[model samples]
Target: MSTSFSNLSELVTAVKAATDAILTTEPKEVKRIRTGGLPVGTNNQYFTTWDFVNGMIRDHSTCTWYSLLNTFEDERFSLDQCCALVHRFDYTFSNFLRYSGFQEMAVLAAALTKHLPTAKTREEAVKAVRTFLAYLNRLAAWLFHYFPWNIGKHLTYSYTTASIPTPADPDLSRRVHVADGRKVRLTWQPLGICVVATLATKENPELCEDVLRELPFSIIQDHAVVSGESMYAWAPVVSTAPVHVKERQCDAPVGRIRYSQATGNKIIVQYGRVTEDIETPILGEILLQYRDRLGEVGSAVWKSTFETKQIILLTIETVD
Candidate 1:
């Protein structure tokens, strides 16, 4: 029989417990298997033992212990197996080296409840899992970097979209590109986990959009940049400026309106002039973008535009 999870929290707890048990047991078993190092009680024992353990973990075979199931079922797993499952979830930060050999915990969470009634539907449950995993990836990176390991290895936690060879100059810390011929110079502070990126682009800031959209982080602050520059590609720092909520009165012309992120979770009633070439499904696009926070469209009304009556007003009300 399969176990059911009432909620994501419950499912996460169970998965974490199982993974922890396996990690604890497998290391001890491996240690016992390789028993003849440095006469058992020497100062070099700690380093030698850790080296062996980490090496075994890295060289683990993918066909057996490191293999991952397509969907998680109620079963025990080895360290590499658990890691394989978690690695799938770490899609956002996949570029980072697997120094510790763990992947996305969120993907693992999604797999664990893939066939369960944890949410109303499998798609909904998966969305929730990915959101939780995004948060978990950030938290885990921070925690792992600071974790007090008895071993001598220091895990690498930072991620970048691209990499360049080590700079010969003391001033050149790292160089990343926002677009062709546009370079962003980065400098790391002493013992700093935080990364500072400064993009040198031309008059057109759209060049930075591609780079911004690929960042693993959710939020960032930009200087002298206008709102909606990237269509919420990355969350911006909160501004103190007054925000105006625009609604199209039935009598008002539909062609004058534009979309706003200021609406928060409210279902959008879009009244605008769309070119014949644009056949985009607005509601569907909105739902896909905010699937975790917003539910389905509660109500939609299509009416002829007040101005020219050529286009239509799409009123999309979403469930909270």
Candidate 2:
């Protein structure tokens, strides 16, 4: 009969006791006994004891136990590395923002691109994809906040021929058939009027209307004049030409008055002499000439062209 026991000492003692009991009961039936050991072919075989002890030791040292410990340690270390990388990236980006003098939103954008996670290996590919998506969302928000001007929807309108009537001179009004066009009476505040007047001759010359086509005059009101009601004293139309006296006592006008249009909702008329040194005036002329291209002049056009050129140059340099 086979017997099983847990402790080594208990197993050895039980075997000895059973052997002794058998020997005493059947001394004559006992086979030749080996000194200091049980017989090779005893009831509990040599193979059984050796196999049981070895199996218990082997079971204790399983691959699953070591693998579990290793996996846990690796995860803890990876988390620490990830946190350190995130902190370092953030610090570097903040420094960049300070040096670059970028707005808060722009700083955030450039920072995220440099610091945002990316897949360097197949193992973390999924995580990289998720991080990239988050970066895109942040970029979109930054652009919207920083740049309010919509590049896609640009509008420009100009008046080719708009008529303005000279104040109630009954005889002149009858003689000169002033086109009774739709009157769009606009009230300009002190600052607004200054802005319009300055831009009329300076930054945007196209906004000025031709004196022959239309006459523009300012009106001061005791009470604010509503669009529908008309109660104001009109200012006189100023001449745009300089009266020049020739050596022979002859007078000649140098320039002519012209009414022009601008891109936005405003009217301007030139009331000054033209000169050779007029680069600023030339810029104004360009504005009038290309009235349809108002929003195209500044950062929008510059950024698009600059970025495209930079990308191409970078690609070429990299290839080289």
CA RMSD of all predictions: 21.9, 41.2
TM-score for each of the candidates: 0.23, 0.15
Model 1 Cα lDDT, one tens digit per residue, 1-320: 12556566566565545433432133222333234332332463544443443333322211111122212222354333444555454333322212222333324434443523444444444334333332332232222222224222254335442332222222212211222223322211121212222232232244233333333322211110111111111122111122222222222122111222222111122222222221111111221222222111111111111111121111111122
- C-alpha RMSD in Å of predicted model 2 compared with the true structure: 41.2
- The candidate scoring highest on TM-score is 1
* Runs with alpha carbons beyond 4 Å of true place in candidate 1: 1-5, 9-117, 135-320
lDDT (0 to 1) per candidate? 0.27, 0.24
